[model samples]
Target: MLPNQSFVWTGATPGVRYRFAILADAGNFLPDQCSTRWGSTDFGSRGLPGSPGFSGVPTRNNANGINVSWNDYNASYGVQHWRLYRSASAANRCSDTHIATLPRSTRSFLDSSAAFNTDYYYTFIASDLNGVNGPCSSNSAAGFRPGQAPTVSAISVSPATVVAAGTTVNLGVSATGAIPSNTVAYQWRAAGQVVGGSSPSYSFVGQGNHGTKQYDVLVSHPESAFSVTRSQNITVCRADQIVSNNACVCPGTLQEIGGQCACPPPLVRVDNQCLAPTPTPTATPLPNSFPQIINQPQSQSVQEGQSVTFGVVAAGNPVPNYQWFRDNLNPVGGNDPQYSFVAALSDNGARFKVRVSNSVGSVDSNEVILTVQSAPRPLRPVLECVMANNDGTLTAFFGYENQNIAAVTIPAGTNSGGDANLVNGGSILPGTQQPIDFSPGRVRGAFGVVFSAQGSAAYTLGYRGTGIVTETANSQSTPCAPIEPRLACVNPEGAGFRARFTYSNQNAFNVIIPSGPNNRFSPAPEYRDQPINFLAALGQSDHFEVVSSSGGDLTWILANLSATASGNSTPCSLPPVCNAGGPYRVQQGQNQVTLNASGSFDPEGLPLIYAWSTTCPGASIAGTLSPLATLNLVGNRQTCAVNLA
Candidate 1:
């Protein structure tokens, strides 16, 4: 049977340990002989209570003392009161003094004994009804009380002397010994009347007449009966006078010389007043002369879209009038000294001169030239041929043709966007060879890649203008053949017909055939402006023209290649505008020179591509991807033949 019983152990030692034991069914047993101990010290012993949690120590300084506040201590143990401790130093809590004992509901206390400008640290501890003290608060609060009186140490007035009527004079008082919690008051009085509020400074405006005024500031604290008074005297002078040694005197610029206002030496007195000296007279004008050119217009080279100006400076009797001429014929500019226009392909080689004239004789400036270059073009990839290897693998020969007048750079690798890459199927070929820098025109066999016999090669290339183009080649492609000659067409020239011829050289290098049995034009003198040096690629042409009044055909033979041009042949289209920059000259030892084709532009505003070719052996060209290409010259006298497409 289960029984519910109550047992009480009364008058136990406060805050002492104890335990209870019960015997289940023994004949006789002591508490120590029981198998289990019900109330051991580990369960918990009765004590005062856990320390109260502090919500934070906040203090306020008042006239009487400092008020300290905290959160009320709430616990299961019955609290009879709270003990408040105060210490002068926070580091030494052992030296803290028992300041006050408050009731259980009191969470704040005022320390009336707090001295002014002295710091006091305070903490709280709760006490149970049995008079047992709990642990002290985890944190201590600091408080301060200010002094009773505000001390005024000094008084000042800015601009001790007022130079003019209606000028403001500032009077200020400085004080100390009053804390932020104490309301320090200020009273500014003039002739026993209040003029300003509680601010420490007062502004006094001088009006009507010149006189000396007194201003006083009384600094005091609301809780103190004592107050401090400081006075400052301000002198208000007229507009024409300033205070000196507590008295008005003449202004600085006009000193009182012999009892009258007088100007200093070098300034004469006019009509009983001081005045400044007269200004010097202007020089006479010189006689007029003929117009003479001072600064001449300089020659400039710029891009097609850019603007160019030619200016001339001249000196003459009357201001000179200006007139500009292009190529010494047509008048292009107005009466201004400068002539400005947008550069175009047609203006590449034109010369500009300005004539400055007035009532005097006119003078002409030296002619200056303007060179405008064309924009850069995109690079194109061309798969020249695929050669079969003896090892059962195929070697694919690849090359690129830059149609621009400048070089084009397509870096090698698939990661290089808009660059050159040789790929098999859809993947880039391993260890493929390709040129990062592609010169202008047809460059045959510039690079090669070896692939398995069953594999086909695809070439991907791009630039700013061409976007991207991919070409595939395999063993079935045509074998390599270097050069071929063809007649473009025959066109009517005045009363006669002209025969035009062109050639395509696929080789990586130029092929030259002199006028002989290997290269000749039938029926007459073979050298009719036909280029002996056949440049590599399709566009490099020795485009020669021969006129026939009798209406006959012309045949050109180069090695085994031959073509005939007749009146019945297809007519050639009109040529596009192009500017090759210059027939530039350099010193014999010069190592480098720059070529520009910025003057070339399309009439439709379409972007123009640059392709530059030179006949100078041993010379290399850099910066072929831009309008400004650098030619690295060999220190030789050989003439360089440059061509632009």
Candidate 2:
């Protein structure tokens, strides 16, 4: 504060008066033809000049956070610093404390320190090199909120019904809008007692002695106080019957296992009974005949490093013994049901034949050819998902699923020597399944991975960051939230004012109102011309905050703040309080000043008029009873007295 520092003189001090006289004579007395006239004039239209804006359109617009960017204010007025302010409502322009104090060197901020489902208002203030604080750039930016809690749904159980007593069942759950802090717990209940716990599935034995037992699987989401239960009954099988197959048998007719009657070893059993033995084939003598091939071996097409098999089926009176031949001539191994070999490149186009010999005669079957193809290379890895972190970064998860003649599964990337080739800008090394975190800012890059058995793949990626500021007013005094990077509004101040903070950046700023249902500041935080509105409300008290979106210092002038009543058109149970031009902190200027009542609103939303009175010399109110009026200043040294009813 240098003496007579003009740069620091943003406006005149309130309630302080100054007089300057341009007299005809430097040493004239009041009786002579020399005089000095002075009066106060309030001048300047509503709204600060020039709109602030984000540098680009927002890429990430979720409630978590919003990224902001803008050009510096005009430098002509010796502007040297800019400050950012936020509140739940936009009404506290005169008293709102800024959350950040940034030098002219940069005009960007990543407002990641936001709470879920909370709306915030962000505005910037510029100051001259001498530390004179300027007015709002525009109104504070409209309210924006952080991401919300997870919504869990789609719960289910596998193998829904029970067949055996000791069967293991699996319980699964899926959720949407999930956050990183969510946890899940599984509990299995039986006989109204905790029988088993933990994990996604529960396994228990059915007790026949207890007859049918009803078991319960409980899935819990304790964070949101939400839980789901699924119930199933397991019946105990009697010794003479099996529930799995509904089988009933007489004593000594079958084996018994786990209180259920069933077949013996090496026999397929169903419904408490053993499968009947296959009827012994009856052999009949027949006349001698040449062996015939009823079913011929088919040609084989196999890739390199793979194996192929061929077989022939024949009908003969005396049955048949078979011998397989390769290339239609060379004899191969044992006489079995089929001939098999691990195919090599040299085996391509090779033909094979089978010879059948019966007690009556023998015959040679037609040759079958073998074709070889090239083996497939490793498939490329694919990016599975990405999540935005509060610290201005992204986490990318990658994996690979191969699609071939047969459904094949491939690993995310090649682990040739411990390191993977995917470049996701994460801290995790390649070949690891854990997601990688991308740093704050725009996400745009390509990542690749080479699979040893599957082909290689490269992917382009992108993600946006969210930045913002805001506050909420309780009908009463309540401490601010996001306790880390905030100055919360308490019950006393701006409790019911319609406050909105609006701003623009080089890209794109927050939407005054988000497009969907959830991104709302639901505790009734209001916005008007961008600054948060703090109308006088029932049981209201005085409140103030000293915090930042990330960093800044603010000096709150508590005495200058006053809340006026304004609400909807609905009738008010209490008397309506008159609002005079929404409050004030005007600087002295050469031209007259205009008062704007645009900031005022009825608590019951009643339309309002204004009334003005002034006693400044050579000054008059443009309209004595109007929301908008002017106080004309006739002299350079006078103060206009203003009072409203």
What C-alpha lDDT values do all the predictions have? 0.69, 0.48
* Candidate 2 Cα deviation (angstroms), residue 30: 44
Candidate 2 lDDT (Cα, whole model)? 0.48
Clash counts for the predictions, in order: 16, 92
Worst 10 residues of 2 by lDDT: 504-513
Best by TM-score: 1
- Local accuracy of candidate 2 as per-residue lDDT tens digits, 1-645: 223433323464322233443334334454434344555442221223443544543224554465556666444445667787666666665357566788877787666665444556566776654455666654435544443445544435456444444445554545455442456666777767888767655665544454566777676655445567767665545435444443333344567665655676667666545776676799876776767888888998999789788988887766788898887668896877588889887898888888899788888877778998755433333453332223333333344322222332223332333323333223442323332443233222122122211122233222111111111111121211110111122122232322212111111111111111212222223231212222223222122222122222222211112222223212223344565663443466655678655444443333456667766777788977776888777656544567776
Off by over 4 Å in 1: 1-286, 382-401, 406-448, 451-645
- Tens digits of per-residue lDDT for model 1, 1-645: 123675666655434445665655544663433347764433324565456555556455475787877665434446777888788788755247888999977878778877666788877777666566776765466777755665677777677644456778777877776543357888988866799999988886786463667778888875555677888766777655656676767755576676455777778666445678887799889788889999989999998778988888789988888999999999987899998889877788889999889886898999998887875566667777764543466556677778777776656665354444445543322333467777888776565566666878877777754467787787788765545667666778755577766677766644445556556776653326666566665443446676766566777776556777667887766454688888888885788889987776443223467888788888888876566899888755677787788
Which candidate has the highest lDDT of all? 1
